[model samples]
Target chain A: MSSEYDTTETLDVKGQSCPMPIVKTKQAIDGLEAGNVLEVVATDSGSISDIQGWADGTDGVELLEQVEGDDLYTHYVKKTE
Target chain B: MSTDNPTTSVDDADSEVDAAELQALRERVEELEASMAAVDDGDDQQKMTIVATQGSFDMAYPPLILASTAAAFGWEVIVFHTFWGLDILHEEKSQDLKLSAVGNPNMPMPNALAALPGMDAMATKMMQKKIDENGTATIEELIDVSLESGVDLQACQMTIELMEYDEDDFYDGVTTGVGAATAIQHMAESDVQLLV
Candidate 1:
């Protein structure tokens, strides 16, 4: 079930290439409040690793859960202190 | 269109032609010289480089697409694959790549719809065919183009070991070794650093 802490944000980078998804996600996270959560949806599978790396690279965000299924990889990340 | 030395040379021995013909020849010579100078101004070429490390199926397209296009500009390009990015290097290319429906909120179908019987299998097959036709080149093609364009290929030893991969695990030009600091220093000197 979706909870208050679980908010969804979709990023359509279909026609676009790689790094773009990561870059767009970075911009999306930047616009949110600290501690706020974001659920990113991307057509590019690269976004999965890209987002994970982005969070690790930033060192301030937290990757709460990564639900990987056959075709989708729904990731949950929270903005942290 | 002034000629520095407008002299009829020995090569112009046919100067005995009528004055009208001589005048026309001079005008043609002047026009040719002017066009030559204009051509010289447009001959210089600009250069650029792109480094793509992401190797997932969907991730793979970014590097291949960017590399092929950037190379089209006649710019020097180098694609480095390390860690999971090495998925593009998987021998069983089919298993190495996936269109990735996981976490893909933008996917048109809901989880139930996606899982509606054997739809998932069909979707995966469809995506593969689309990418393949759309120039989602195979790992072999990726490595070949990089070689033809003089792309320097570097692999991360740490990542390789962590993933329990070996030399046979990589392709021809790949050299096994290089860490993050190295990538940073290298990219810092590049015109573009594209992390897929």
Candidate 2:
């Protein structure tokens, strides 16, 4: 997943559900500089929509890509103020 | 000559009226578009308000979950805990809130069995186990997440007085003794208002 897109940081939130994935994602994204890409790996099936919806509604962040791989959901998000 | 061109005069008059109306409509569209663009770029944070009326372990999850989730989405969140929901903010009661099977249609057991002594406690224990197994955030953890995410957790003032709960019974970040009028004002402006 890292090979697909250059990521500044990767957050793995496996075995966590509802709001935790997004909560932790927001926290991680907050630490990155503008234009830095964050890669998030989540086990929750809902993270796909959760992260996408969160990024869509939230300012200063953009979801670049989302990939589902072998029971894991991966998302590439960019900080765009 | 004028009588012969009466139809042309009517057509000219209609064309002039249409031109004026079209210009007015075009200006209105431009104003609307500009305002819409401003909204898209402005700091218009979405707001969500929830009224939590139940204190059961099961019922407690919904309001907190939605509040934290909305906060995660960068929306302003407010949760008003009233009546039995006061247990959710009570320092000790929050950890001990029970899931009563009695009179609950969702409980798989028959009503008679649900009414048996220790049934509610057993159900609550089982639910807690499931929650742990699912890796779901506990009520305490959710409260912390909500507070850290800037969700406003309000405890109803009337409920506090009626239940005789001390001011210190709630968690640290809670906005205790908030009035219904205050909650109503928030709800009125909230983009989403829920009764959970």
Candidate 3:
């Protein structure tokens, strides 16, 4: 369902909760080169706002979009630095 | 000769006005540069300081959760575990921290029933079960995340001495025996401060 941006990596945090979604997202983005996009799949409902708020406050990363499926949340993050 | 004097004065006044405008523009550019640099350095990084004063099973989550979350946000986070809060950083104590139902109003049972001999154990077990069922991060897991994310975990010196806790009792990477003065200094310098 994600076709807008070419995702460089996909991080599966489907069952992780709270800080793990964001923490794992950060780690994934860190390993990526600048301009690379990361796709995050999560089951935690809080990841919607958590990833948004995290991207809003953090530098060198941009949250492109969030796709909500039947039971999963997909977040597209771009490493801007 | 009179014409020459007027022309000379006008030219002189025009040059003086230009010099004043140039100086003002220069000062404005310097001010803008300084603020831009501040934004690059100071505004980019924020600091948070928290004083954790409780050690119950329920109470332990807030500090660690907030600390790890803040660290994820790229903020410098410091959590000072004082008094009963020191139990959270204690390797053995943290794993076995109990939920006391005796004085807790949140418990559904009557205070009398909650004060029964085995109530604390039952409550602790119930909460642990809930945490497991929900897939929530355990206290130990949160501690690991906080450390891995570079959150500064500090233990109160006075509490360690009063409780006769060995310095080795705390988890690795925790800054043990930190004085109140150090905690206060961090709080003063932090952009956000909390006591929980």
For each candidate, the alpha-carbon lDDT, in order, equals: 0.61, 0.92, 0.93
Off by over 4 Å in 1: A1-81, B1-53, B93-95, B113-121, B133-136
Per-residue alpha-carbon lDDT of candidate 2 for residues B150-171, written as tens digits (9 for 90 to 100):
9999999999999999989999
Model 3: how far is B2 from its true place, Å? 31
The prediction achieving the highest lDDT against the true structure is: 3
lDDT of 3 by residue, B162-189 (tens): 9999999999999985899999999999
Those runs of model 3 whose alpha carbons end farther than 4 Å from true positions after fitting are B1-39
How would the candidate models be sorted by DockQ, starting from the highest?
3, 2, 1
Model 2: runs farther than 4 Å from truth? B1-43
Could you estimate the TM-score for every candidate? 0.48, 0.84, 0.86
Which candidate number would show the highest TM-score if scored against the true structure?
3
Q: Sort the predicted structures by lDDT, highest score first.
A: 3, 2, 1
Compared with the true structure, what per-residue lDDT tens digits does model 3 show for residues A1-81?
767899999999988888789888987887999999999999999999999999999999999999998989999999999
> Model 3 in CAPRI terms: which quality?
medium
Look at candidate 1 and tell me the lDDT of residue B183. Answer: 71
TM-score of 2: 0.84
Looking at model 2, residue A40 earns an lDDT score of 93
Clashing residue pairs, candidate 1? Answer: A71-B101, A71-B102, A72-B101, A72-B102, A72-B103, A73-B102, A73-B103, A74-B103
